[model samples]
Target chain A: MAKELLKGNVAMAEAAVRAGCEAYFGYPITPQTELLEHMAARMPELGRAFVQAESEVAAINMVYGAACTGKRVMTTSSSPGVSLMMEGISYIAGTEVPMVLIDVMRGGPGLGNIAPAQGDYTQMVHGGGHGDYKTIVLAPASVQEAIDLTALAFDLADKYRAIVVVLADGSLGQMMEPAELPEMQPLKKQLPDWAITGEPGRDRRLLTSIYLQPEDEETTNIRLQRRWMEIEANEVRYQEYFLDDAEIVLVGFGTAGRVALSAIRHARAEGIKVGLFRPVSLSPFPAEALRLVARKAKAMLVVEMNAGQMLNDVRLVTQGACPVDFYGRMGGVVPLPDEILSEIMRLARFTPHDLNGHTRAAWLDRLEVVRGAK
Target chain B: MVATDIQNAKLVYERPESLADVATHYCPGCTHGTAHRLVAEVLDEMGIREHSIGVASVGCSVFSYNYFDMDFVQAAHGRAPAMATGVKRVFPDRTVFTYQGDGDLASIGMAEIMHAAARGENITVIFINNAIYGMTGGQMAPTTLPGMKTTSSPRGRDVETQGYPIRMSEILATLDGVSYVVRRSLHNPAEIRKSKKAIRYAFETQQRGLGFSMVELLSSCPTNWGMTPLDSLTFIEDKMVPAFPLGDYKVIDAVKSMKWKEG
Candidate 1:
């Protein structure tokens, strides 16, 4: 099929529907509301389930319940709404049912503005809810990547019986771009053996998160940890640009990553040996690939819409192989390519031989300068 | 006895096939076991056991999945109503119900239950209102009587300060989406029978596509009440029934016209 102009939220909703999502339960929140609106209009026409829940708590539980029936189910929300959903998210993870969630991230910490931000990196990539569980986090920088990753989210969820999150920012959720959608997949007819369908000719199934026993709970944790190992081994995805013999590397994901790509191109045009590394899968993050890049580069600059969340992950993987500097825009601020281009230019000029770990002082100085100018 | 020997014997009384053979963890004299038995017998009578799914909520009823011999999932505290909505929407043909306690249904979960009923979801709900959070060791509940004493309300629930107890059945009845909503007691054999009938009606409401239906059973928690099992039953009859009252709170025309099932 030919590519058509599509908005990010609408494109993701369509991608989820085509990927055989049988049910959608959502509450209206800024940035991600368009995705829920699209589902509300389309799911019923296709004879599937769509429910507008009372809150994010209800939405995620509804997704949990629908998921237990061996159906493709999902919900979309923004930062504060996803925060409200953490309780149900932990329960869903505890139940070990497969479901999809889309976080169209906005500014955060609390009730932040509804603009582009990447503040949920730690929540999605690491543990947010209680327990030792792993969620597959996918960061899509553009409308096309959102479509592709949204489709893949369902497959990976089913393949592992885990939650898969499409972690996009407000800008990607609101922007329109030309993209080709995948062919619609037929919904699955056979329920998985572990599904709670309550149908005849099969033994009844019970799916619960409660173990009530320390030993039994340990076993459940062990199972989740074991499943996570297989995921880390097989599902590491990233894109490298102009990294051959480059001394300065730039790291980012989602909108920040997309912006960094532009900065890398501009710096390269100015005769700077700068490259870009964009991580798509943030949980089973492409650590091995970054290690290789760090081995060659003298310095790396991490850019984000938040104040250095994913930068920590990059620093961890790089492990002093290179000095990792950071530049970010927070609280609904979207950085321009030139802002990152300058950060690259700064890092290219001063190749720090030691770890640049005290980022707060530097970050505060920049924030103060900007606030003073305002 | 062997299968042949048992066939000749009278099967006057036995556990319902829908009820699991294992023992329940409910405290002695607690009416949750009785409530479970009534529901299992109702499911057996309807012959929907093979296609029934139960969502167990947090509290004393959280482990209800272990007592029902069918597909079951345990929900987070107070979210069973939303979970039941999801299950019912997915498998409309399957029998779906949530077993929740006072805290799970009337207090923290009020929004979920109210919305599910307002949406007229085609699902049944078995709400056990013991007036206290039994599993949490007797904290005051939304259904707790104004003067009833609990762990949290040791000085007795002061109506002037703590506010009055909520009548969920009465509140839910006002919603246009509900087809059947009623309050029943399990304090005696007669009331227990009545409660069972109400449960059957609730499930029938779902099977007939009549939208949401619920039966709020005033139950007893002997340990939490600090009384003997017998006294706890009397407490429900003497204190709870008078405070909460009982009767059909809501019944649509179709539900009222249906013949009562005695089986």
Candidate 2:
């Protein structure tokens, strides 16, 4: 298909449709409303199911319902709305219903403003809902990535029989870019054997998350853990940029990762060895990849539009092989490329010679100064 | 002698084919089993049992899926209507219905049920209003009458403090999207028969492509009500009916002119 200038939200919505989403249920929340609006206008014309649910809670449950029929279903929301959907999402996870969810995230902690932020990194990666379950969390950094990832989300959801989340920030949701839309895939006409699609030529089917017995619930939890482990083994995704000869690395994802790429290019032009390690899947987080990068780099700077959420994961993977630093701007503040470039420059100054001299203590004192200022 | 007489007698009360042969988990004298039987009979009579999809709501009827011999999806508390809406919208040719409780429909799920009705979703809703939350032990439900003492309302449901009981059928009937809305009791055989007819009419409305149809049956939660099954039947007739009148709240012209057909 020809490339079209599309907003990220609209592109993702169209991509989901092309990916053969059979049903969409969502309420209007800023940053992500356009996706819901696009689906509203297009789904009915395509003869698919669409509902402007009364609330985010209702929308997710509707997706849960449609998913039970073994159909490709999805719902989208922003921060607070996603919080409202946690209960339904947990239920979908517990029942092992395959569906896609798009979280075009805005600022959080409350009814925060609708500006771009990577505040939901922990929530998405660590399972926001109640219970020990995991969702396939895909962080898309651009309009094109959003479109591609939203389509891939459905396939992954079905493959794992689990919820797949496309976690993008407000800027990615609102920005316009040229995207080559994928060709439409035909919808599946026959329901899967596990689907609850009326009982003719089959035994009666029931789909639920409830397990009254403790042992039964434990068995289900174990099965879910095994599936998650399998996903972790096979579905870890990341993008490496200019890492072949680099000594310093910039780690980020989503909008921040995109921003860090510009910083890395700027740093490279200045003769500073900085590369970018962008995680595409935040849940099965590219820990192994980061471990490899950590061994090659002298220092790593984790950039985010939140107060160092993904930094914790980066630190764990790096395991002190190299010093990992964090630069974040929270509450809807998008980190500037120059700011990240400066952080990269600061990391570059921590050479082996400087580590053995007063320059090391000076850098430590400067870090203390920075922390005190915050 | 009785066995010899039985061999010569006709069996008039065999279980409905649409009903699964599993033993119910309902408390003795609870009307959920009766309501389930009515829905199963209606589905069988219409011959839509094979194509019917039931969304079982979270409450006592959460396990209702196991008792019905059709594809069933169990929804989280009060989400049955929203779930049913999805199913019906996706498979418009198939029959879809939600079985919900008073707490599930009138309390936490109030928005889902109301919007589904207001949107005119082509589905049937079987609401059992037993004036208490049965599944979670006797707590005050949205339909709990004033001065009714339960676990949560130990001092009796103070009308000033706890608010008035919700008459869901009457409330839902006011919505323009509803094609049929009725409140029936299941306290006696005569009332049970009427309730079944109403259930049939509700399903027929859905089958005829009419808008939202719901039959709110005044059921008895004997264990939760702290009454024997026989006394609970009397409670529905004497106490519940006066508060929630037994009558058709709305019957749109399309539903009134409709005739039930064998699929």
Candidate 3:
């Protein structure tokens, strides 16, 4: 296949079509509108359905309905729109529907801003919807990665009988990079037997979330919890950069991880043995992967677009194995490599405090309002 | 006891293989059973039971999924119409319909139901209007008559405070995409027969690829109304019928082609 420059969002749409997704339903939101626009142009040509729904709520239900028929389906939105879809997402998860949701995240507590942010990390990984269901959250860093992971998302969604979220951000959504478009994988020979297309002289099929009995709820929750544990055990993914001989390591994801990789290269140029731990799976948090990096490094710097949201997860997995410091730039600003390198130097020289010791009341108070809205 | 049991026997009910054999969970003498029977009979008569998909909403009628033999998907309160739109759009050849209550369709799902009608989604909706939230223990519904008393309105619904009841069929008939809109009641045997015809019209319209079809059946909730089953039917005939008149509000079948427009 010939390689070409493609924005991450467009690449994702192409990959979704190639993956045999027959429907794309979404409401336009910033940084991710290109994805829906691409599908609107391409899906019709592919003999598929493309709908710009009246709202995110409607868009997700469209996905739910199409998925109920066992058709390959998807929808894309940004942060605030994704928030509006959480109720539907939870329903989809509870019902065990196979569909893909792409969140090109933006800064938010409210309509925070239409810029990149990693603020949705906890929401994505810790079951952004509700119930004990888990969505396999794939974090893509580049246009090619976005394309590849979107293809992977469908496979994972169908295989696991779960919703799969492709967690990218505005920069990755907008940035163009050279991507080698893979040949479309042939559609699966069969869909899940539970999907309800029509009766067709067979027993009627139902795709629903309601289980009226209390014991049914208990059984489903237990089954979902075990499935999540299995995913955590098997699907952890990460990229190790210069951790062979290093005293300090940087941990980040999505575009922030790419920025951190550049920062690590810069720090190495100055003989600062700072490595990078870039995660490909935002959910399942790559716990063991971070543990391995923490064991080899003296301290870790966690960089993100939100006020240290992923920091809590990192600390939970690492368990104070090494001091973890956070450098966050919220409300659409991505921290520059120069700024991150300076933070690396400060971590190397100054005795690092626990990440919690540095909370600014101004930001914390603002986050309080965001929390209430949720 | 024998006389009471005999009196409770329903003469209007038909034994349909497509419907569950169990007694309905609806309160005795409740018109929901009558409305459901009408809808079920229509599905069976059209021989579309094999191709039908029903979406159940939040109310006493939410258990509609359990009664229909067709594939059923229970949706969030008031969102069944939107969900049904998605289902119908995905499987355009299939018969998709929503069974919703006044609270679900006229109140919380107002935007969803209205937009689906406006989009002319080829799906039928069987709306059961009991004028109160039956499942939630008789709270006031959007269609509850202005002076009707409910758990939420102990002193009777205040017209000055809460305004008037919403007439959904009247509101829906104004939309150009709506192919058929009818309001029927299940209080009497004659009304029951008319309700079945209304439901049949809705299904037939969708089969013809006409736009949205709706049959709003003015139903009775004996438990919620704090009345016996027989009294509930009387209440529907006396109280509800006067407020929500029985008649076809709109019927525009686009599939009937015009010879002058065609070659």
Candidate 4:
């Protein structure tokens, strides 16, 4: 297919449809609304299901129900809306039904503005919902990558019977980029044995999260843990740029990662020996890769659109092998290439005390000094 | 009782094929079993066991999926209607219904059920209104009467403090999307039969693409009500019925004009 200029949200919606999404249930939330709107237009024309639910709570439950039928189903929302969906998300996760979710993240702990932020890094990658279940979290840095990851989300969801989240920020959702759309996949003719398809002749099927029995729930949890172990072993994905002979490493994901990539190129030109390590699978955290990067590099700077949420994970993986630093923009602020470039420049002139656990606090202190800047 | 003559004799009564052979977890004398039997019988009679999908809402009825011989999904508290909407929209030809209790339907799930009725999603809701939370042990439900007393409202439900009961059938009947809305009871055999008939009519309405349908069965929670089985039934007749009247609140013209014989 020829590359077409497409907005991230629209491209993702079309990608999901082409990926054989049989149903979509979502409410209007900024940045992610375009995805739902596109599905509203496309799904019906495709003779599939589309429901604009009353709330994100309803939308996620609807997604949960459709997922029970062993069909490729999806729902999209921004941060606050995704917060409302946590209850149903936990249910869907606990039930072990497969579904795709796109979180075009915007700001805040409250009803933050509709601008871009990586605030949901901990929430989506780490379990925001209750209990012991892991969602496959994919962070796509560009519109094209968003389209590719959107298609991948469905396959990963069905393959592991897991919830696969495409975590994008507002800028990625709104930005237009040239991307080739994948050919439409044919819907499945055969339903999975566990699918609740209302077929009478087959032994009846059920989809539920409730394991009232303590031992039974434990067994199920262990099974989920084992599946997650398999996922961690097989599905770790990351992109490394100029890491072969580098001392300063920049770590980020999604938009922040892309911005760092630009900074790395500029920093390398300045003889900073800076490299970019961008994790694509945010959940499985590319721990070993980061550990490897940490062993070789003197310092690492983690960049994000939030108050360094992913930094916590980076620290855990690095395990004090090397000093780590943080730079972030909170509440709808999108970090620019120059801002990261400066952070990388700062890392080049780094002193031993500069890259400590107090890294976030010192950055926040400096951040408050400015009125509004990325 | 002679097995020798059983082959020649007529079987007067038997468990509905839609119901599992095992015993239910419902407390002895609770009307949830009766309500489940009514729904199961209706599904079996209508021959939709194979084509049906049941959403079991949280509460005593949450285990309804285990009892019904149909594709089922247990929903989060009060989210059954939304789940049913998802299932029904995906499989338009499938018969989808939600079996929810008073607390599940009237309290936490008020928004979901109201909106499902408002959308007229061509699904049936079998709402069991026992006026108190049975699963959680005597908590006051939204349908709990003004003066009714339970564990949560042990001093009696004060209209001044807790407010009056909500008539869901009447409330849902006002929506344009709703095709059939009826309130029935299981206090007596006659009412049980009528409830079954209404359940049938509700499903038939859905089958005919007549939009949303519901049968609110005024059930009894003897253990939670702190009364004997008979006294609980009497309480439902005396106090509950007056608060939540049993009648057809809304029978859309299409449903009213159309003939539906009990299968």
Best by DockQ: 1
**Model 4: per-residue Cα lDDT over A16-65, one tens digit each:** 99999999999999988889999999999999999999999999999988
> Model 1: what TM-score?
0.98
Between candidates 1 and 2, the one scoring higher on lDDT is: 1
- Tens digits of per-residue lDDT, candidate 1, A1-374, equal 89999999999999999999999999999989999999999999999999999999999999989999988999999999998988888888888899999999999789989999999999888878888888999999999999999999999999999899999999999999999999999999888899999888778899999999999999999999999999999988998888896899888899999999998889889999988899999989999999999999998888899889898888889888888888899998998898788778778777778754677668668667755876
Task: Show the colliding residue pairs in model 3.
Answer: none
Which wins on lDDT, candidate 1 or candidate 3?
1
The better-scoring model by lDDT among 3 and 4 is: 4
- Residue B94 of model 4, lDDT score: 92
User: Tens digits of per-residue lDDT for model 2 on B106-205?
Assistant: 9999999999999999999999999999989999999999999999999999999899999999999999999999999999989999999999999999
- Residues B83-168 of candidate 4 have per-residue lDDT tens digits of 99989988999999999988999889988998899998999999999988888888888988888888888899999989888889
Estimated TM-score for each candidate? 0.98, 0.95, 0.93, 0.98
lDDT of 3 by residue, A270-320 (tens): 998888888898877788878877876788878888888887888888888
Tell me the TM-score of chain B in each candidate: 0.95, 0.96, 0.90, 0.97
- Candidate 3, residues B1-263: lDDT per residue as tens digits? 99998899877655775687777788777777777777887778778888988888888887887787778887877778777877777789999999999999999888888888888889999998989998889999898897899999999999999889999999999999898999988888888888887787788888888889999998888888899888888888898888998888987645333112110
TM-score of chain B of 1: 0.95
Model 3 interface Cα RMSD in Å? 1.4
Lowest-scoring 10 consecutive residues by lDDT in candidate 3 chain A?
A: A358-367
- Clashes within 3 Å, all models in order: 0, 0, 0, 0
